[model samples]
Target: MRITLERSNLLKSLNHVHRVVERRNTIPILSNVLLRADGTALAMKATDLDLEITEETPANVEQAGATTVPAHLLYDIVRKLPDGAEVFLATTPDGGTMTIASGRSKFSLQCLPEADFPDLTAGTFSHTFKLTASDLKMLIDRTQFAISTEETRYYLNGIFFHTIEAQGDLKLRAVATDGHRLARADIKAPSGSEGMPGIIIPRKTVGELQKLVDNPEATVTIEVSDAKIRLSIGSIVMTSKLIDGTFPDYQRVIPTGNDKEMRVDCQTFAQAVDRVSTISSERGRAVKLALTDGQLLLTVNNPDSGSATDELAVSYESDAMEIGFNAKYLLDITAQLSGTDAVFLLADAGSPTLIRDTAGDDALYVLMPMRV
Candidate 1:
């Protein structure tokens, strides 16, 4: 295989495909990236069995062939090359070693037969839809933070994606929870997505998809099946196996009767919670929120550390109530609010509190109170 490509273009594609290659692999071929050169472009593929990423970039092909090489090493070499340098890659007839040269620098890397690379088959997709990159990013940003990290409950380790009918209109919803806190966000369902099956997109796929949709103006095409999900944007294609588990009925956890309400500046509330939590103990890191007619008091007390209290004027008219919450949980939920004001609907000191952005009703958060 012999190919010539601009250093910048090769580096960009390498950065995308290399991340999918695991640093530690028991199989030799799994640690390398498969490079196929033909016609006018070079295709790069990397996978870890469960997830695979393929990218195609334009290159000058002197001799068309395919080979596999160390993904990280090639990425590092190309990254450190001088800007605008042309990268030349060629493999011997036996394909034992690959030669890489740019300007005054040259190196030889061992190559493996591309035939040994694992083949990833994307099963039949039941649904295919298109979404604006920005909208897709919003869905991920709003709920990914609440995804559980516990491997035992693998079902909760990914964002639950499905379509729901609301007010006679269909909408795409993303929900995630880690038992303590839950986040739900919705957007208008794209056409052709009707009757889409609910699927749990694994955390790793969520992260890779986020990077694939960096261009806000670009349109992302998503194809989903019972076992796999594929995301495509321009020349990049990301495919991953879905988590085979059932997600809990999240609506049951979302309270419906909570009426007591308090509205406060989102930034102000988050800052106060962050400051007072400094005095909280390392284990619990709990903070108490006392809300009265027009004032809200935030306090944290730790026996080994110290105590802190801050007061903020708020829009609360219900009877006085004090609730205990994990400081980090509050910060995570509040940080997602894009509006100026955050509205909290409370039932009692012991029940879960519901949070919403004052500007939009498309998203909501629920947090279970802690015993202070």
Candidate 2:
């Protein structure tokens, strides 16, 4: 295969596809990216068997052919070339090596037969829908932090997507939970998503999709089946395998009867928690929240180190109670809040607390308390 393309265009397409290639692979062709030149474009593909990404860039194709080369190596070479430089890629007659030439720099990369590269066959899609980039991003960003990293419960390692009827409307919801915390977000269901089956998108695929939905105005097409999902944005296509286990009943864990309400400035509470936790022990970094009438006091005590306490005024009318939470977890939940005031609904020191934004986003969070 032989092709010539702008360095910027090649790099942009490579940047999108090369991330799917693992750094180490047992199969020789698995670490390589497949390059095919034909019909005035060069198509680049990279995969780790479970996930695949493909992108096409405008190029001057001198010959219609295909080959595979080291993904990272090709990316590195193209990245170091001068801006606006034109990159020329050509494979040798014997198909043993591919040469890259840009201005004064030249390099040769070993080539593997394109036939050896594996394809992630998407058998049949049962549902297809379109989502605006902003909506998709909102659902992912709100719930991604709560996805469990535990390998034992593979179902919890991904964000669960499904449709449900709530408040007399069909809504598309995304939910993610580790054992300690849960995040749930919803959007008005799109037209074609009404009867779609629930699917658990794996963590890695969620991460890649998150990066691609940067343009808020762009539209993303999603095709889903029971075992796999395919997403397309512009000239890029991504296909990934879904997690193979049933997600737990997340609705049971979201507390519904938390009666105590505490309203505090989100930024102020987050900063106070950060300052108090500075003296906490590494392993036991729990911040204690003591609330009484309209006053709130944040404290962190460690026998091995000094202790800290910060007091602030809050809008709490419930009976006095003390609760402890992991300082890191508190910060994570606070960072996702968009409103100035955060409302926390609490039942007691031991029950889960519900958090919501005053700005009226369709997202809610549940956090379990830790022992002080």
Candidate 3:
């Protein structure tokens, strides 16, 4: 294969595909990326058996052919090249060695037969839909932080995406939880998305998809089946195997009987939590919140370190309540709020607390209280 492309173009394509290439793999071809040159474009593909990404970039093709080379090495070489430099790539007839040259620099990399690369087959999709990039970003950002990292509960290690009826309107929802805290966000479901089966999108795939939709103006096409999920943005395509497990019914975890209410400035609450957490040395970093009429007190105590206390004016008219929570969890939940005020719905000192952004009803968070 012989192709010529700009250094910027080569680097951009490499950056998109190399992240999927496993650094250490038992199979030799899995560690390499396949480069196929045809007509006016060069297609670069990388896969780790479970997930695959392919990106096509414009190139001047001297001869149409394909080859496989070390993904990381080629990415590094292209990244270090001068900007706007013309990159030349050629492979030998036997496909044993690939040469990459730019200006005064030249490097030879070992190549494997492109035939050895595995193909990821995405079976027929049962549902396909379109989503604006900004809405997709909002869905991920609001819930991804709560995804469980515990491997044993594999079902909880991803975001549960599905459609549901909310106030007579169909909405697309993303929910994630790690047992201690839960986050749920929703957006208007696009046309043809009705009756789509709920699916758990693995954490790694969610991360990769987030990278592709950084441009708010872009539109992403989504295709899903029982076993796989596919996302396409412009000339880039990503396919990932969905987690084959059922997510728990998250509705049961959200507290509905909570009657105590407190409204506080989101920024003030987050800053207070951050400051008080410094004195907490326990594993949970527990912080105590004392609420009363028109006032809220934040405190942390650690036998090994010290104690901290801060007070903020809040709009609370319910019975006085004191609750304990993980400072980090509180900060994470508060950071998700896009509004100036965060509303807290409390049942008691022992029950889970419901949090919401005053700006919208489409997002909610639930946190279990710790025994302080």
Candidate 4:
């Protein structure tokens, strides 16, 4: 196989695919990326058994063939090359080695036969829909932080994506939760998306897909089946296996009886939590919230360290209320609100609290109260 591609184009495509390749793998081919040249384009693909990514860039394909080369090594080489330099790649018949050259520099990278690479199914799926690049970005950014890092409950490790009815209209909702906190965001679904099956998109796939999308106004085609999902944007496509286990019925965790309400500027509230958390020790990052009339007092106390308190004018119309929560959780939830102010619905000190955006009913977050 022989092909010539621009250095900048090669670097961009390689950077997208290389992240999907694992650094250490039992199978050598898993550490390599598959490069294939078609009529006028070169495709770079990398997979980790569970997720597969393919990126295509414009190139001059003198000969149509395929080869596999070390992913990280190739990425680093092309990244260090001159920005506009043209890259030439050629492979020997034996497939024992591949030569890569840019300008005056030449390097021979060990190669594996393209047949040795793990096979991926470019399977056909039903339920195809288009999502605006910006909307998908907002869905991911608003809920990904609450994804669980614990391996025991693998089902809770990804964002649950599905279509649901809101006020007699179908809406796309992304929900993520660790035991302590949960985030849910919704956006109006385009026509023909109603009745699609719910799927849990794994965390690693979410991070990879984020890189391929740039223009907020661009449209992305999404296809989902029972076990896998595909997101295609221009010359890139990402396919990932969905988690098989059932996600917890997250609706029950959302508090509806929380009558004590407080409305505060989201940015100010987030900054106050940040400052107060500084005084708390590393082990327990706890912050206290005290509400009365229209004023909110934020405090953090640590027996071994020090304490902090800050006051902010807010909109509160209920009896006095006090609650404590993990400062990190509070900050994460507040940061997701798209507008200036956030509404906090609290039941009591030991109960769950509900949070929503003041401007719209598009998204909601729930936090489990902590003992101070």
Top lDDT: which candidate number?
Answer: 1
Tell me the spans in candidate 4 whose CA falls farther than 4 Å from its real position: none
Worst 10 residues of 4 by lDDT: 206-215
Show pairs that collide, candidate 2.
none
Model 1 C-alpha lDDT per residue in residues 1-372, reported as the tens digit of each score? 999999999999999999988899999999999999999999999999989999999999999999999999999999999999999999998999999999989999999999899978997999999999999999999999999999999999999999999978899999999999999999999997899999999999898887888899999999999989999999999999999999999999999999999999999999999999988877988999999999999999898877999999999999999999999999999999999999999999899999999879999999999999
Write one digit per residue (lDDT tens) for candidate 2, span 16-92. Answer: 99998989888889899999999999999999998999999999999989999999999999999999999999999
For residue 357, model 1's alpha carbon misses the true position, in angstroms, by 0.7
Q: Worst 10-residue stretch by lDDT in candidate 1?
A: 205-214
> What are the clashing pairs of model 3?
none
Q: Residue 180 deviation, candidate 3, in Å?
A: 0.7
List lDDT for all candidates, in order: 0.95, 0.94, 0.94, 0.90
* Local error of candidate 4 at residue 65 (angstroms): 1.1
Clashing pairs in 1: none
lDDT string for model 3 (2-26, tens) is 9999999999989999999888999
Model 3 poorest 10 in a row by lDDT: 275-284
Give the root-mean-square deviation of each candidate in angstroms.
0.8, 0.8, 0.8, 1.1
- TM-score for candidate 4, please give it: 0.98
